[model samples]
Target: MELRVTNLACARGGLTVLEGVSFTLRPGHALVLRGPNGIGKTTALRTLCGLQPALAGEVSVPPESMAYAAHADGLKATLTVTENLAFWAAVYGTDLVEDALQRMNLDALRDRMAANLSAGQKRRLGLARLLVTGRPIWVLDEPTVSLDAASVALFAGVIRAHLAAGGMALIATHIDLGLDEAEILDLGPFKARSPRDGGPASAFDEAFT
Candidate 1:
């Protein structure tokens, strides 16, 4: 499967944040979005995942084949780790909870309540949800937020396995994810200029360009 974006424009709260964004991600590949905070990296990912509409241009990717994990882990505090994966598995019509548990190295803690897991463990559980979804495209936002060195290595291994199996991923992160040969999409060039910075000539402008 391929994710193609052409001249995409994104806005938040009626303000344009990114414009003329475009990229193509093919099977077995990954794209890392890099930029400073508030540069619309999240907005672009949201647009790609269909959580929000793009203000302009086109995004072509099958929704059914995509799985998105936001910055928040989104785990139910009262549920066991296994239960959480099972719940998501049922929702996605897949039964890979056992495999996901083992893949994320959460087998020992599988029966523990999500509330009892450390931040890193919870993040791993959140990532494991992607495995159960049976989707080919993974959209992750700051996936390594709380992971230590070993945990980050583990996550990288999982991503590598996915790509080896012809899966694609689009990730937005400030830290290096250690994915070998991953394409980079820096969002800096796409940042929209503020009107006060002489972006476009307007009647209200004291000095029009």
Candidate 2:
């Protein structure tokens, strides 16, 4: 599947957060969204994931094929790791079984409550949810936030494997994702105007000029 964003913009409380962001992500590849803090990276991901509305422009993808993981590790505190995985598996129709737990080194922590897991472990569990989710396209915001070196390497390996297997991802991160061939959409160093109360301008309008 292919995911495309064209001139995407969003407003929060009358402030324009993202302005005319555009990119295309295809299977076997990835797109890294880079920008300074408060530049709407998270908001952009949220809009793409349907958590927020797109005040302007378009996000084109099959709803069923998209999966989104936010910066906040959205695990239920009372649920066991395994139970959380089961819930996501049932929701997203992922069939990863034991392989995913082994990959994230969570087999031992599987029975532990999500509330007690360390920050890094919780992040890993969140990623493992992605592995079990059968979505073809992933929208990940700060995917490796609290991971250690070894866990980061493991996450990179898993991501590479995913791309090699014809999956696609759009990651918003400040750190290197270790994907050598990934496309980098650097929003920084761009002379972007802060959006007015109405929202940002559309890039498509200039496409005809």
Candidate with the greatest lDDT versus the true structure: 1
lDDT of 2 at 198: 36
Tens digits of per-residue lDDT for model 2, 30-64: 99988788777887778888887887888888566
Instruction: Give me candidate 1's TM-score against the actual structure.
Output: 0.93
Q: Where in model 1 is the C-alpha error above 4 Å? A: 197-209
Q: Write the per-residue lDDT of candidate 1 for residues 1-209, one digit (tens) a residue.
A: 58899999888766788989989999999999999988888888888778888889898866677899998998999999999999999999998999999999999998999999999999999999999999999999999888989988898999999999999999998778788859999899988777866564334443553
Model 2 steric clash pairs: none
Lowest lDDT sum, 10 consecutive residues, model 1, at: 200-209
TM-score of 2: 0.87
What residue runs in model 2 are displaced by over 4 Å at the alpha carbon?
Answer: 189-192, 195-209
Candidate 1 residue pairs that clash: none
**Winning model by TM-score:** 1
